[model samples]
Target: MSDQGSSTSTSQTDGDFEGELDEEVESEEGVKEKGRDSPTPSLSNFSASLRAVIRIKQKYQAMKKRRQEMVLGLGAGALVGAPGRTSPKIFTFDGLTPSAFPTLSSIQQKKKKRRRKRVLFPTGGGRKAMPRQERSRATYCLYLLLAILFLQVYNAIENLDDHVLRYDLEGLDKMLRREVFGQQGAVDGLLSHLKDYLSTYVHNKPLVVSLHGPSGVGKSHLGRLLAGHFRSVVGETLVLQYYVLHHCPQEANALECARNLSSHISEMVERAEEEEKIPLFIFDEAEHMHKEILDELWQLVASKQSNEYLNTIYLFLSNLGHGHITKHMLHNSSSISMAMTASGRHSNLLKELTPILRNTLEKLHPLWTEADILPLSLLEKRHVMECFLDEMTREGFYPDHTNIERLAGEIDYYPGAEGREYSQTGCKQVVAKVNLL
Candidate 1:
């Protein structure tokens, strides 16, 4: 009985399964029929289908986003752990490390070696400083050269004044003092002017000396002495002695005389300049010269003349101021003798007489105004006696003092101040008197 009950139960289960299958088939057919009968879709059915498709697209997008997030998380984890791992070595194109290249390493070593060499030898060979003593010696040599240059300049200045030595001024001074007696004042004035003019080669104008005195007070004698002396010094060709009476007499035409005098002066100056020498011109008896002749002489000695005329000496011996000069000496004999004795006061006597002589000469001709006037005093009785003795000796006679005094007494005298007797004709007649003896 238990076996029977088991089969019935099994059959009933099979019957139930068959009934479920048939119902499912019939329901599918009924749905198809409904689809055929309706023909068009409804609004509700279409909306539901659209809702289902949207939900499916949303789900797909959510899946893709999750996949990307997972991939990024994996990459971040690898980077965070990369620092703990060993770094790979980089290599150049030649497959060698940069520091391992031979050329680069040699270049760096050479640069370091050059730096060391520069530090050790800065000045190319390390030259030492000069010793202190040697430096001082060099400085001393420089100073010695400077001192020698100074001495050379000093010697040059000293030589500049030596030009005056060639004229032999010392001998001239002695000759004037020794030979020209009783005219010490006149001699001094003459020498001073000569020395000043002859000391230099350059001059602005010619030296014009005018000697004024009475006939016998050595006016003509002095002029002759000067002419002779200059002839000896400068040569006879450079010295000219012009006598107004002899060369240009009163009977001669005034214009002819003037022309002759001018030509003579111009010729002399030209010759002297060529020889580089100073020429001397002596004019005796100048008071008798015509106004035309005087004017010609004035033009020659004027400062406006050519430079050749400047280096000349002119002597005008005249008796125009004789009376004024003699009168002055007689009135001031004592004071004049004193002044002649004192060297310092010698110029004072000339200062007093120069104006009187100048005024007398200027009245005759304006040419004398440019002259350096030197007036001679009247000769004393003693001076006249000296003249007598000199002339006696020259004539080859004994210069006896008694004879000299006797001859001097024959000359006229102007009884001067302080019991002084001055000769009127001075030494003018001494020669004639000596001849008589």
Candidate 2:
């Protein structure tokens, strides 16, 4: 029985062992089958991986296009981000992507290009545009205007110091003759001295003239003539006429005249030196002017700036010393009565200032008359006739020249004067005389 039991156990043990081994082999097969069923890496898997990678790249490309569109939209221009479109979509991105947009210059260039294309392909042909001749004329006009503007500017700059330092004395004489009638010798002498004085014009060395003559003589007339002629030399002509009886009478007004005269002169001469012109100050009826006024003038003449003020002429017209001059002439009547040759004798008479002149004027301005004091003499018959004709012409009356001699004989002369000689009024009444004719 022991043997039997042991053999049975052995058989069981073997059977169990066989079963276990079979199960083990089956588990191994199952494991191998599972492994085979699962996915295996191959060429097809590689292709599928490449396809995934291509899909990601396409997504990235789309994002870049969106970003570019957003950047173009953000450009600071009204005509920006593709024209004729509004409400453009803004692109979104991951962290802090740098933005870019088109510049104004680029946008302008694009607009210009579009305009050129439109112009080249207009609705009509080139004939529809403005005419070529008119367009060319407009362009030429613009060029000419610019050229004229440039020339005017250039001339203004160049003429800054334009002044007449030297002038034609003979021309001045001719011009004076045309305007001022009779007193040919006086006119000629006045201009000759004036020309010579102006030739040596320096700052303090002014051309001072004391026109001492009879009341009706051409003292004031000659002054006007000088101013007119001076206008030709300087581009501008202005006279500061101080009619002593009119502006500031002698007595109490002389001091007032002195003060006002200084101011007046200063104003006229303020820019005179700068503009390169000599200021003309005419003291008419100068004998009537106070000694104080003369002193004031002397101060101006002696001023340091006076030496710099060139070509300035101070004209003093007066009848103060005429009586003395006439008396002196009467003493030497035979030689001096001849009006034509009276010019040379005038200097000699003035040199020996007659009793009345020496007393009244010598104390006033002793040196004022040291230079040539022009003494306008009485006019003769021939001079009066010429004066009458000139007066007629000035009055716009073209009376016959043949009637001039006959017309002059009718004008009245002084009691001592006869034979068509001038009156005591000289050429003063000549204008009225011609008017009556």
Candidate 3:
């Protein structure tokens, strides 16, 4: 019974050991399968994470590129649209649209429209009338200024004429008419020349008057009168009465006379220029003057000399044309009387005689060509009688017409036309005859 129990126990123990070995093998296989499956799942998860990161980077790059394109588009639009109206087309960047920038012209037009509306509709209510344009004080002031300027100009012009009148020319005219006799035409011519010259202070050349007639026809008297008048008006220093016989009698003194004459003229003219005055130079018995003296006078008055000589008056009293004057008076005594009454006829008569006188004096010297010739006709009997009466009155003698006639009759007379007698030597001996009284 003990042996059978031992055998069963041994078998049971071996079965138990086999079962434990099978269970260990199964646990090792399960562990190997778990390791292989774990490796595959970890590798797959790593690949998926890498792909997601790459996609995210690509999306960020696309967004940055779109932003750059939008910036470029905005810059281009602003540059292109600056000079003209803003484009009507919409500008888009990555499907985004912004409002258009307003242009300068559009803003100005809107402002103008607002202004027009404000003008059409007054804030007070109804439209107001247009404002009247009142004249400003400035306009009247401008007119007043123009009027004052015009008045000033007019006054200045009047003053220029008044300046000429200041020389007492009317007084000179009256004196000539009162004192000088029987040479109405000559006096007229002389007065006219004086008026024309003295009217202006400016002169281009000296005035030269050549008086031609007989010795006793009042040429020297006229010279004396002119010298006296000018001496009173201008001054004694500015009046030079030169006589060939008195100043230079001898032929040997001709050169010295000429030098003296030139120096005197130069000094006189210079002084007169300083004083702004015109000088008078009278040459009595100019026909008897030497060629050198005449030439000196001519040089002083020549246009090429100097401006100081321009404002001077020179009188040349000569008996060179006395023959022609006598002949003319004898032939035209009746016409001359008529001329004395009519100014036109007197001028015509002077016109006819001037050329003849000029031609006659030109034979003696060429200096007469530059001179304005004035011829004194032979005095009538009545004129000589009047001269005698004037001298007697000047000498404080009784007023006796019969004695004047008797004295005038003593002078030689030339038989003239229409019972008119002309004195051969006009008023020559009247002074002597009066002194005898």
Could you say which candidate leads in lDDT?
A: 3
Ten-residue segment with the worst summed lDDT in candidate 2? 157-166
Please provide, for model 1 over 210-229, each residue's C-alpha lDDT reduced to its tens digit, 9 standing for 90 to 100.
98888788878877877777
List of clashing residue pairs for candidate 1 = none
What tens-digit string does per-residue lDDT give for candidate 3 at 39-82?
Answer: 55466555654664565456546655654555455445555635
Candidate 3 runs further than 4 Å off? 1-166, 336-345
Report every candidate's CA lDDT: 0.75, 0.64, 0.77
Which candidate achieves the best TM-score against the true structure?
Answer: 3
In terms of lDDT, model 1 sits at: 0.75
TM-score-best of 1 and 3: 3
lDDT of 2 by residue, 1-437 (tens): 33343345545655655665566557555655655676775666556556655754665566556545544444323244335334433334534544456778889999999987764334765656642453667889999999999999877645432222345576777787776554665676777766566543344466676677786667787777666666666545345667878887647777788888888777667566666556777788887777778878887765555444445678878887777665554455455545545456555554676445646666778546433466666655666777777778888888686788777677666544333344566667777777785
Number of the candidate with higher lDDT, 1 or 2: 1
Q: On a 0 to 100 scale, what is the lDDT of residue 106 in model 1?
A: 91
Looking at model 2, the pairs that clash are: 203-306, 203-307, 203-308, 204-306, 204-307
State every prediction's TM-score relative to the real structure: 0.64, 0.53, 0.66
